[model samples]
Target: MFLSTFFVVFLLGVGQAQPEDRSKGLPTSFPVPHTDDMLFYLQRSRNENTVIYDLNRKADGTVDAGNPINVYYIRFARDGKPWPLKWIERKFAYGYSHKKLKNQSGFQIELVAYDERKIELIPS
Candidate 1:
């Protein structure tokens, strides 16, 4: 009876164990890139690398109609530099398709990897 009770207690303790926090003890000086055209950036708990979304502009200082958002990676793990997505990443991961909204109010952007959630980009 004592052995069975101990086994049950051990199993309960193991089940109640909490997962380690990966963000804990990480470096505080993670690099952040800033640019004039950058709209925003995203970071994940998986790594220090960041995804940047910027305004795609034409030579005449106007936003590109067909592709208004330029997406790329700021690889902090490598050299903390900006890098374009590879072909596979573009087609399967982070690449997005956008369409102009009616009356030119904004755009409806859909991510290639996750098409269920729609993002609206309205120019100010």
Candidate 2:
């Protein structure tokens, strides 16, 4: 009876040890060639930069899926103009169907860059 109870407890402990997330292979977004921002995105949700990383069993625990997208590296063309949020939208078709876009682009992404952490998309 004692051994059976111990085995059950051990199994439960193993399952509980599992983390809530797994890391995906998506690379962190790099700058657009001029700026210093970092970016990473989810291909499944082309327009959405809220890339989620699922729990992945990697050799090192440092890397994982679903890291937040960084947008410091890319630069705007005009001096004052910024990389439009629409750029990510149109690039990934944020509002449009992803399946259609995927067929053409095969899940590529355009990284965005900004100094402030807040996404410019939301209206002030």
Candidate 3:
């Protein structure tokens, strides 16, 4: 009886899944099956000891091209400055499809920065 109860409890514990984390300030993954005017992705970047700390996608000419987005990339020049780049947005280059963003493709967005240090991505 005790063994059976333990097995049941174990199964229940496994059933209860953990929530996804995305608090590292990393950009979210881009959408696949990219439909019209879909949110590609959002992320942060670094530069050679300097961080660009600014972004402006609409101004970056990355505005939805209707399909096959360029997925423009961006870096930083802020050695010890804030992020978000000079404008409001940056481009994406590559990545995996997110479960939350299933069917969405990964855009290649490079972050130009002088910091040299690499950053990781966290889904939000």
Q: Please name the candidate that would achieve the greatest TM-score relative to the true structure.
A: 1
Model with the higher lDDT, candidate 1 or 3: 1
The candidate scoring highest on lDDT is: 1
The digit string of per-residue lDDT tens for model 1 on 9-112 reads: 99999999999887675656656879789977777666778888898989997889899899999989778888998899879988889998998768898889
Task: Give one digit per residue, the lDDT tens place, for model 3 in 37-119.
Answer: 33443443321222222122355545332222333333323333233422333323232221222343323333442223333
lDDT of each: 0.86, 0.34, 0.35
The parts of candidate 1 lying over 4 Å away from their true place are 1-29
Off by over 4 Å in 3: 27-124
Q: What TM-score does model 2 achieve against the real structure?
A: 0.18
Clashing pairs in 1: none
* Residue 1 accuracy (lDDT) in model 1: 100
